[model samples]
Target: MLDFTNDSSGGEPSSQAVKQDAISDQALLDAYSNAVIDVTERVGPAVVRVETGSKTPGARERGGLGSGIVISPDGLVLTNNHVVGSSRQIRLRDNEGIVTEARVLGVDPDTDLALLRADGARELRYASLGNSKSLRRGQLVVAIGNPLGFESTVTAGVVSALGRSIRSVSGRTIEDVIQTDAALNPGNSGGALVSSAAEVIGINTAIISGAQGICFAVASNTAQFVLSEIIRHGYVRRAYIGVSGQTAPIPRRHAVAAGVDNKMGALLAQIEPDGPAARAGLLPGDVAIRLDGVDIHGVDDLIRALDRDRIDRTLEMEVLRMGRLRTIDIHPIERKPSARQGSAP
Candidate 1:
C-alpha cells in the first residue's frame, strides 16, 4: 500500500516552516506601514494649503492653490514659485484649520522655490529639511500635499532616480532634481517630499502630465541654498558670463592634444556681443574644460561654478580651441533680471 502519511522532510516546505515564513512577511509589511504612519503623524501637521490671488478689482478671485510646508517655528513656509506666481495676496491654512496671511519673503524662479513668512505667526509646528545628498535610489519616501483641493493627503513611493534636470517655469534648468514614483497631481506642487525619518528631503514640484509614476521634486540641498539666499537677499545673486552653450563630447585627439582629462565640455555655441566671454576672447566654438581650476565638463558644471561669490571676480577659464589648450581670464558680472534670454554661464 502506498504511504498515505504526509512527509515533513519532503521537497515542499513543511507546515511549520510555511507558518514562520508568513510571519516574517507580515512583519515586513507591518514595518513599512508603521513607517508611513509615523511620518504622517509627525510631518503632516506642518503641511499647509497655499492660496494665492491678486487683490486687484478686476483680477480673478482665486488665482492659484497648492501646498507648502512650514520650516520654522516662527512660520517660515517654503513652496514653489510657480504656485505663488505674481499674486499679491497669499493665504495659508494649516492642518488644524487655522488660517493666516503670508507675504513672500523671496522667490528663486530658477530653482522653482519660494519662501514666505506668515504674518505675526509664532510657535507654529514645522518640519526639518534633511540631507538629500545622502538619498539613494529605491529609498522609501512619503509625499504630503493638498491634491485637487484635498487637504493633507499622503502618498508613499520610492526614489526612482537622482541628479535629474528639469526646466522651471522661468525657462531655467533646475539641476540635481530628485525623481520619484510618488503620485502627484495639479495641487501637489510646493508640498513636502519626506524621507522615512520624517525629514523633508525634497519639495514636491512637478509631475509629468500623461505619464504614470513619474514625478519630480527640488532636492532639499538646492532648496536650502535658495532659502538662505532669499532670507539674506531679496533675490538670488547669480554670476553670469553671457553665453549659450551645450554639452559636447571632447574629441579624443583634442583632449589628448590639450592634455585635458575631461571627456566632455561646454561648447560655446553663441557668445553675447561685448559680454564677458566675448571680451575675454572666448569664441563661439571654444569648449570650456575648466573654470578657475574647477572642472567644467558640462553647462551645469559651469553654471554652478559661477555663483554669487564669483561675481565681479576674474577667473581663469581653460578651453580647447582649434585642438590647442588656452587659458582665458574672464570677469563674471552680476546677472541682470531682464537678461533671461539664454542660458547664463
Candidate 2:
C-alpha cells in the first residue's frame, strides 16, 4: 500500500511539518480578514451619507452624493466642499437610517474641508480624533465611507507614505496629505481614515485618477485645527505676514549664538512693499530669530504657525540685522479670496 501523507522516503516527520506550515498560513489569512471586518463594523455607524444640490438661474437644482463623518455628538460633520459644492440643499443620513436636512456652518476651499450642522439632531455618533503626527509608515489603517452610492463601505491598507502633497481636480495643492492604498471612491470624501485604536487620523478627500490603490486624505491635525476655527468663527482666520523666504545655512556670526554651525533657517528672499515685514522695517538678509516669541528655526516652521491663525493678528518677531538684534511687531493680512480654491474643477 502506498503511503499518502509521506514522501517517497515513507517518513512520518516530513508530512507533519508540511501540515503545520499550511495550518499556520491559513491562520494568518483568517486573522487579517477578521480584523478588517471587525473594524468596519465598529466604525461604520459614524460614517454618513450626504446629498448636495444647488439651484442655478433658469435651471433645475443640481446635486450629488458623498460621505461625511460625525465629529461631535451634537451633529457636526466634516466633508468635502466640492461634495457640497454650491449646494443650497444638504441632506444627511444617520446610522439609524434616517435622512434629514443639514446646513453648512463653515468651509475652507484651500484645504477642501467643510463643516456641517444638522438642525435639531442632538444625538449623534462621533468618531474619536487621533494624532496624525505620531503615525508611522506601514502602520495599519482603515477607511470607512459610502462609495458609488454604496453606503457604509470599508477598505483597509497600510500607510504608504506621509507628508505627501497632491493637487485636487481643480488644480489646488493640498499639503501634508496622507497617502494610502485603500480603495476610495467619489462618495468616500469626508469619511474617516482611522488607526487600529479606532482614532480618526485623517479624512478621505481625494484620489488620483486611473491609479489603483492611491488615495489621499487630509491629516487629522489639519482637520482639527480647521474644524476648531470654523466652529469658533464663520471662516478660517489665517495670519499672513507678507514675506516670502527660503532656507539658507546660518552665517557664522548668528550660528555661534544659535549654538550650531551649518544650521538652516529662513533666508529673507523678499519682503513685500508696505507689507507687515516691510512696514515693520525688516529688510532683506535679516535672519529671523523668532516669531510670536516662538523660535523660527526654518521657513517651514514659520509657515506652519501662520497657516492656521487669523489674518491681521499681531505677532512679535525678533531678528538679526546687520549684526544687530531687533524686535518688531507685525500683523498679517488675509490672502485675497480670488485665489484659486482646490485644483480647477
Candidate 3:
C-alpha cells in the first residue's frame, strides 16, 4: 500500500553518509535508462491508443484516452476494464496510424482487465510474455504506454518489489501485483512492462498519489488469465471463503509469554453467517495457520493462496481454536459477481 501517485519532490537525504545511497541509486537508474528504451521502442507500436466516449443523463459526451496491448494476430486487444467502463464508443489506433472501432469481448471488473476486438486487422504485433514468477527485485524493466496521449512512451526502472495488493479506483483489490519505480501516468494503464528481450512481464496499472516514481502493475500471468476469461465467459470466476482476517505472523515472544494460551496464527476477526468458514465450523476467534500445507504468514500469503482458485476447490486449513490446534477441510464458494467488491467474509 505504498502510495506513490503524485509527489514529484525528490527524496534526497540531508546528510553526508546518505550520499552513497543516492550515488548507487543514480547508477542503477543510469544503467536502466541507457539500456531499456531501445527494446521498448522496438516493441511499442503494438500498444494501441484507446479512446472512450461516455454520456450521462443531461450531459454532453465525455471522452478519455488510455493505452492497450495487442494480444493476438487478428486484433484481440487487452486493456484495463476501467478505461472502457460503460463507454458508448471505443476506438483503437495502432502505431501505424490505422484507427478502427472496437468492441469489448469481455470485461472483468474484479481484475480490471478487458478484451477488445477490431475486425479485419492483420499482422498485428505482439509483445512476448515474460514469466512473472521469474521477476526479482533489482532486475531491470521498461514500461511502454501512452501517458497524456503520447504513444509508446517508455520509462525504465528495476523491479522494486512484488506480491503487492492495491485497490483500484473501481474498488477491486488487485493482488499478486508488481511494484516498480518506472513512471506510469494516467493514460498508461494496461500497457506493457517488458524485460530486456521485450517480453511483456507486467501490465502497467496504477500509480499512488503524492509519491514520485513509484508505480504498480499486474503480473503478466494474472493479466493473461483474466484476459482469457474475458474472451471466454466475459467475466472471471473467483472462489470465496467466508472469513475476514488480518495477516500477522505468530510472534515467538508472544507465544513464549502466553505459554500456548494465545493464538498462534493469522488472526480471524470476523465471520459471516452461513459463509464458507462458518459452514466449515470456523468461528470468530480462529487463527488460520496454514493452507494446504503452505505456512500462512500474513494476509497477502493467504490472499495469494486463494485469489485464483475455482469454486468448490477444497483447501486444507490448520487453525488455532480455543487455545488448541485444529485442522479443517473447507470448500470455497463461488463469489457472486456482485459481491466481488465486498470483503470476503
Candidate 4:
C-alpha cells in the first residue's frame, strides 16, 4: 500500500507540501475573485450603457454608441465624447435595465470626456472618484461597463503601468493615463476603472486593437477636474498660460527666502509672446515662487492652480526674478478653441 501523505522511501511529506501549495493558490484566487465581485457590485449601479445615434439632416442615422458612468445623484453621466461621435441623441440604460433619455450637457473633445444628463431622474447611484496619482503598478483594478452591448460586464486585471500619454482621436494629448491589463471590448468606452475600494480610479476609454490586455483610461484626477469644469461652465474652460516650463530644484537659499519648504520651482523653458505672462511683464528666466498663495513646487502645481475658475481672474503670482522676489497680478483669459493648452512653448 502506498502512503499518499508522504514519500515512503524518504518520508519527506511531499504530498503534504503539495496540498499546502494548492490550498494557498486557491486562497489567492478566491481573494482576487472576491475583490472583483465587490467592486462590480458597488459600482455596477452607476455604470451605464450609452447608445448614440446621429440626428443630422441627411446623414447616417443612429450609428454609434458607448458606455457611460453616472457621476451625480441627479443623473449626470460621464462618458467618452468619441463614443457619442457627432450625435447629440443619447439614451442611457442603468444596471437595472431601466432605459432613459439622456441629453448631452457638454463635451470636451480634447480630453475625450462628455457630460450627459438623464432626463429628469434624481437619486441615481453614482461612482465615487478616486485619486489616480495614488495608483501603483501591479495594483488590482476592475473594469465594469457595457462591453459589446453586454450591460454590467465585469473584467478584472492589474494596473499594467502608470503615467502613460495617449493621444485622443481629436489630436489632443491625454497625460497621466492609467494603463491596465483588463480585457476591454469595443463597447467598453466610458466605463469605470475601479480600484479595490470600489472607487473609480480611471475612466476606461481606449484599447489597443489587435493587442491583448492593453487598455488605457483617463486618470481619475483629470476626469474629476474636467467633470467639475463641465458641470460648472457647460464645458472645460481652460486657462492658457503662455509659458512652457520644467520642474527644477531651486537653491536652498532661494527657497528659504521665499518661505517655501518645497525646494523645487518652475524653470521657464519658453514663454509665449503677447500671452498673459508676457502681458503681465513676466519675462523669461523668472522662477515661479507661488500662484494664488499656492506654493511653487513644480510645473504641475502651476498647472493645477490655473483651472477654469482662474480664467479671467487676476491671480497674484509671486516669482523670483534676477534674485529679487516680485509679485505680479496677472489676469488669464479663456483659452480659445485651437489654442494650444497642455503646456505651450
- Best model per TM-score: 1
TM-score of each: 0.86, 0.71, 0.72, 0.70
Candidates in order: C-alpha RMSD to true structure:
3.2, 5.9, 10.9, 6.2
| Ten residues in sequence with the least summed lDDT for candidate 2 | 336-345
lDDT tens digits, residue span 84-138, model 2: 8777689998667888789998888868888999777468778878899999999
Model 4: lowest-lDDT 10 consecutive positions: 336-345
> Which regions of candidate 4 are displaced past 4 Å?
1-13, 54-61, 240-332, 337-345
RMSD of 2: 5.9
Between candidates 3 and 4, the one scoring higher on TM-score is 3
- Tens-place lDDT per residue, model 4, 260-295, is 676788877777888999889888888886988888
Evaluate all candidate structures by whole-model CA lDDT and list the values in order: 0.91, 0.79, 0.77, 0.83
**Model 1, 223-305: lDDT tens per residue?**
99999988887778899989988889999999988777999999999999999989999998999999988999988788878
Position 123, candidate 1: lDDT: 69
Q: Which of candidates 2 and 3 is the stronger one according to TM-score?
A: 3
Ranking by TM-score: 1, 3, 2, 4
Q: Pairs clashing in candidate 4?
A: 53-62
Query: Which candidate tops lDDT?
Result: 1
lDDT of 1: 0.91
- Model 3, 187: alpha-carbon shift in Å? 0.9
Q: Which pairs in model 1 have colliding backbones?
A: none
Better of 1 and 4 by lDDT: 1
Candidate 2 clashing pairs, residues 3+ apart or interchain: 170-343, 170-344, 170-345, 171-343, 171-344, 172-342, 172-343, 237-310, 238-311
Evaluate model 4: give its TM-score: 0.70
Worst 10 residues of 3 by lDDT: 255-264
